[model samples]
Target chain A: MHDKLREHIEKIVPLSDDEFSFVCTHFSIKKFKKHQFLIQEGEVAKHAYFVVSGLLKLVYTDDTAKEHIVSFAMEDWWESDYYAYFTQTKATMSLECVENTQVLCLSYEDYKKLCDSLQKMERFFLEKANFGFVGAQRRIISWLTSNAKERYDQLLKQYPALIQRVPKSLLAAYLGVSRETLSRLAP
Target chain B: MHDKLREHIEKIVPLSDDEFSFVCTHFSIKKFKKHQFLIQEGEVAKHAYFVVSGLLKLVYTDDTAKEHIVSFAMEDWWESDYYAYFTQTKATMSLECVENTQVLCLSYEDYKKLCDSLQKMERFFLEKANFGFVGAQRRIISWLTSNAKERYDQLLKQYPALIQRVPKSLLAAYLGVSRETLSRLAP
Candidate 1:
């Protein structure tokens, strides 16, 4: 389990064995059944999870109670209500497991403590966070300018694995299109 | 000057005066005239700029040679071709001064060095990067689901200062709308 976590961190910044061990001590392993809510709207998000297995969805509901799927995370991906986590505000979105899931959970407090102790981990988190920001910005630009078919094509081209694992309805929601539109564009 | 820089960093992390001095030493102050290109496409982006005065626009050209305004930055805001800087690839966007601008520039190497030296600065960068990622994601979702008027309204609500600084044509491009459309929607 520690090896899996180490591998994930290594992709961002290679850590020495001692440093990896230090980080492992701060994280707690968590298991969730299908349809379990890892986080909910209106509550502060205290933990961010790194998925070791299974799938989870990040979703938001509007004032009218319409659900919009924002993102889906599978193996090796991290999920959190980042705004709530960073600002210590009530979450605007919810995280739900779409399948039985195993995750490495790191509390915000522990994560800050780890960053204070480990320079390499601090660099890793900063670089990874910046990369995530760029990807999110690109996704926003693409969604704004592209049509439904264009979005479907781009998603298939960029994240083929995610497209393969995610349900069409959820994908439609993420693309801001109807289920029928996504169905028609499905290859 | 150091006090202002410290205030900027303090928004993200509480930094001690000594730490702020260490971080500030890595930054070089630079000035750009209106319409001058701070960074150009096809070149590696060596530094990220933190605006101290005036405005800057980040623009990308599509296949057709049409320019798309991605963002505008004013005092205290950071702007760069982050995709290029992080990946060490050629920049896809160019940074241009919209007015005579003064900025604090820090290279990637110096940034890494500062993060290694000061844990607080590293945490500040990580937190700001995470906030940026979440904001970009929300903007993308809004763009995908909302109409032109809605996008305009959302932008007005979120970044009214940015809207005030940028020209209508540039704002339209940033919003992925035409100048005429934006003109019609504006009160």
Candidate 2:
């Protein structure tokens, strides 16, 4: 599990064995069963999770009690109610396991400590945050310009594995389309 | 102009006078008249602009030649074809002045130099990137949950000044609504 994290970090910045050891100290590991909640809306989001295995979804439930899938995290991906985690505020979203999952968790304090202690780690996070922002921007552009079929085709092309793994109903929610509409796209 | 940049940076991380002087060395200034292009699609994005005054729009034009407003940048905001700027690739979008604009420009090389020389700048960027991601995520949620009128109301509530400044057509483009639809909502 720790090896998975070390590999993820080393992709962005080479970590010396000693530095890797220091990084390990800042994270703890946890596992959840399928359908278990990692974060609950209205609770303080305590940590950001790096997936070692399995999958998780970050969801927002609207005033009408409709669920919208904001994002998904698979192996090697990170998931959190980031605004709540960074601001130490109540979560407006929830995170739940889509599969039996294992993740490495870093609390906000530990995140700051890691960055303060290791400039390389800070650089790694900076790159991640920049690309993360870019990805979100692309999604917004897709929403502006793409029809439902185009969105479905783009998702299928970009993340074929995700398409296979995620349930159709959830995919509909993520695409902001009805399940019936999704069936037509997928079919 | 440098003082405005200093104030923006200092909001996240305090810099000594000497440090601010060093930071200023990494930027050059440019002024653009209304409707002038700062970045054009298929051209390399050379710099990220820090707006000192006036307004700019980042636009993505579809194959049908309809333009979608990705975002608007105003005083104190940053604008660029960021994916192209960071990756040194051709821009897929164009950035143009909405009002006669003055901006401080930082090239990718200078941006890296600033971060390498000052850990405080890296920290400041990380915070900005994180919040930028949060802001984009919120916009995605709004799209998934709100109708045209609701989105317009939310935008008006959040940035009253921006509503007053930007043209309604651009606002409609940004909201992924038609001008006819926007008129119905705002009127």
lDDT by residue for model 1 (B1-187), tens: 5567778888878877677777888999999999999899999999999998999998888777777887788988899999998777889899999999999998988988887777777788887898889888787667645788988999899888878888898888888888999999985
What local lDDT score does residue A176 receive in model 2, on the 0 to 100 scale?
Answer: 97
Per-candidate TM-score against the hidden true structure: 0.94, 0.99
lDDT tens digits, residue span A71-179, model 2: 9999999999999999999999999999999999999999999999899999999999999999999999999999999999999999999889999999999999999
Per-residue lDDT for A183 in model 2? 95
Best by lDDT: 2
Interface RMSD of each: 1.7, 0.4
lDDT of 2 by residue, B44-135 (tens): 99999999999999999999999999999999999899899889899999999999999999999999999898999999999999999999
Error of 2 at A166 (Å): 0.4
TM-score of chain B of 2: 0.99
DockQ: which candidate is best?
2
Residue A7 CA error for candidate 2 (Å)? 1.2
Worst 10 residues of 1 chain A by lDDT: A137-146
Clashing pairs for predicted structure model 2, backbone only: none
Q: How far in Å is the alpha carbon of A127 misplaced in model 2?
A: 0.1
